[model samples]
Target: MTNPDDPRSLELVETELPQLRDGEVLVKVQAAGVNRGDLLQARGYYPPPPGESEIIGLECAGVIEDPGTTGRRKGEAVGCLMAGGGYAEYVAVPEGQLMPIPEGYSPTETAAIVEVACTVWSNLGMLADVRPGQTVLIHGGAGGIGTFAIQLCRELGATVAVTAGSAEKLETCRELGADILINYREQDFSEELKGKCDVILDIMGAKYLQQNLRALNEDGQLIIIGLQGGVKAEINLGALLPRRLTVRGTTLRARSLEGKAEIVRSAVENVWPMLADGRISHHIHATFPLAEAAAAHELLDSGAVTGKIVLEV
Candidate 1:
């Protein structure tokens, strides 16, 4: 039998505390966001990039535990979209990726907001150039990223359309400013939304690709941020040419520290204020103690969470 003192499984092991480098800040994690990438990593199908620690979480909010060659005062609360290791009691992030927790936001609330906001802003705000008056179609509209994307797109003056699995989830999306809601289980969304959108924020991949491209208006952008559906498929450039549609995909965990830090900088300058002033709120579905992270992951894996699942430390 494996000794509890030397647990070998992903969730049970307790290793020596990790260290921080120059330009890094050690966070005493209060809560961590459980993302899809964490699930993949725990299964050993994905790993943090080179130079990143082999821990499972991607983002967290916490108090500063140690400062390494940086000027951040210890005990100040901060939030970070990290490369890995956020599931622990402590995680180190480069100072550049750190931001003061949004004013009036507690660590748990900030934990729910940081990753989805960073992800949406990076892909929708930066890459796709989603602008006001453009219509955006978002899939998985009830998930963490979708909820944030719906609000941010609306805040940007775009008309928003979304597809969730149920009427209840659709109502939540609509409450968050979705102009149109499609229940995928009951209707053909792209068929219902024909020629209606100027941008598409897609989470389901190849399965929706063809119809999504058909749904875009001229000069439209389709940015795929998740592949909940299978990834491989053929692309029809012919369909894209006349509409000038842009189909692109991105993953946050694979990005470089510098790239993610740039995302953090932009989010703090832009999206953070919306959160601080109550124009945007983190959709926290539930919280569990740090030791219950496996259950949290199972919850996320179950597809029942309407928003983020957080592990409180």
Candidate 2:
């Protein structure tokens, strides 16, 4: 999607296959995962990181086009974390970012898994170290990241709390084993869980900043991955100091190749087992053909999608 204001600007243009740099593998993409990062890039608010593709996609599933040294063999079915270009029929990714598809998963299903798994694992498990018995409060619990997080945190032995805008969505969260369900539209979420959270996976930014701090217990960590609410907000050091709180912000697309590779490594090692063993499954809210990318974005904007929207290429 090129134009920020109009989806019609997303024209499908023909292009030559991308050149392979050192440590890169060519992928014949069968599906791609749509993320909020793609939406922001469509709006021109988040452009590609330096030297990355202008095409708007963050993750994909495909077969390896050639033998590569990063542990993937030719013709292997793999899912890749991409900086961009997953929307195309083919994309070139750094070898370290490609991982074998989870056992028995289709290309489309596996496409939706990598982005959320890598994201939640990196922030909650690796960064915050949200261990067993801790309390995790996740906002936007019906989202791709939120759904994956609730299940992962629960499996890790944490009590999961989630805030969704509707009772129906809250029920879905409950089905996912979220212990505490808050209907944000009808309840004061911070008051409901004040001083009770060990970790908060937040998507709402400035709007929830203060309340997120209030929701934290001593030594709590708040990881901000999205800024849907707003960007800038005033934080009281007085409160943060006494609580010994930590606030960290991160994104997957803007990282260096090595950084993303490490995150993918951790995700494959830890999260892939759960998926392959049937302890966890990918949730796909909707699917669309590659040509109907705008409609997929429209579905995403509808605010009713329960999980991910995958584009079949």
Candidate 3:
């Protein structure tokens, strides 16, 4: 399966799964979650963490083949984020990153749900400390993490506003509980949203920096999770300081195993109940076979998807 002719564009030739380490479990992957970073990694822009597998998928849902005395049981339905490599038919993941698939959810569905929940929970729920009735302006509201953020923030009693490229995507955001929709292509978001936001969750850091600052209310928090538009930015510290705005940035991929595991555990405890009760649901825009990973990358790169995309192995 590792040869050039193997037909899986995401996997390099001669790639092989290594023996499971002491705290690792082998997963028979049924589906893998696709993220924009996966495309970057395929193009050699993002490198896997040292000592982790070189395979390119960050998250997957599947059945456990062996638990390796890691407290996981064989045949347990589980989802996990790999340091690398989830596009393959099987992946060995550290036990710490593993979470059981919510009851009755398909592996394909669970694959799409896990990554978004973890990302939003860590950023909005844990870091930002979003409070009830506060307004959250989320950039890319129709994308994977944005969709989840809308639902999670609403569940926590925050008013959600989203910026998307189209009215159609905005409608989807509305269904997900977004109270305000700004079509960025047609309007200046900062000008439209001026003085309306209590918190801003941004992915296009530099592209939206100045305006994002302008949109915030006093004591607002700006949490940046991605630099989709480019990293460099110039900010007036006076604007930030006088407004009592807090600016923060983070990346989930570089986190320690323990930190990631704690996030997974917290999500299971606090957020999974919402899923079980149907208060939060996943929105899957499309699914592709694992072998057609390049096409999945193309779809995400085009920015045409309204929600999460998944790969069935």
lDDT agreement with native, every candidate = 0.85, 0.91, 0.87
16: Cα error in model 1, Å: 1.1
- TM per candidate comes to 0.95, 0.97, 0.95
Q: Which ten residues in a row have the lowest lDDT in candidate 1?
A: 1-10
> lDDT of candidate 1 vs native?
0.85
* Model 1 ranges with Cα > 4 A deviation: 1-10
The residue-by-residue lDDT of candidate 2 on 1-313, one tens digit each, is 5668764357678999987878998999999999988888888888888898888899999998965555567898889998899999989899889898999899999999989999999999899888998999999999999999999998999999999999889998999989999999999888999999999999999999999999999999999999999999999999989889999999888889889999999999999999999778899999999998988888887798999999998
Return whichever of 1 and 3 wins on lDDT: 3
Best by lDDT: 2
- Cα lDDT tens digits for candidate 3, 3-42: 3332235433545666799899999999999998787777
Runs with alpha carbons beyond 4 Å of true place in candidate 2: 7-9, 68-72
lDDT of 2: 0.91
Tens-digit per-residue lDDT, 160-236, candidate 1: 99999998899999999999889999999879888888888888898888889888888888888878787887988
Candidate 3: give its CA RMSD in angstroms: 2.7
Q: Which of candidates 2 and 3 reaches a greater lDDT? A: 2
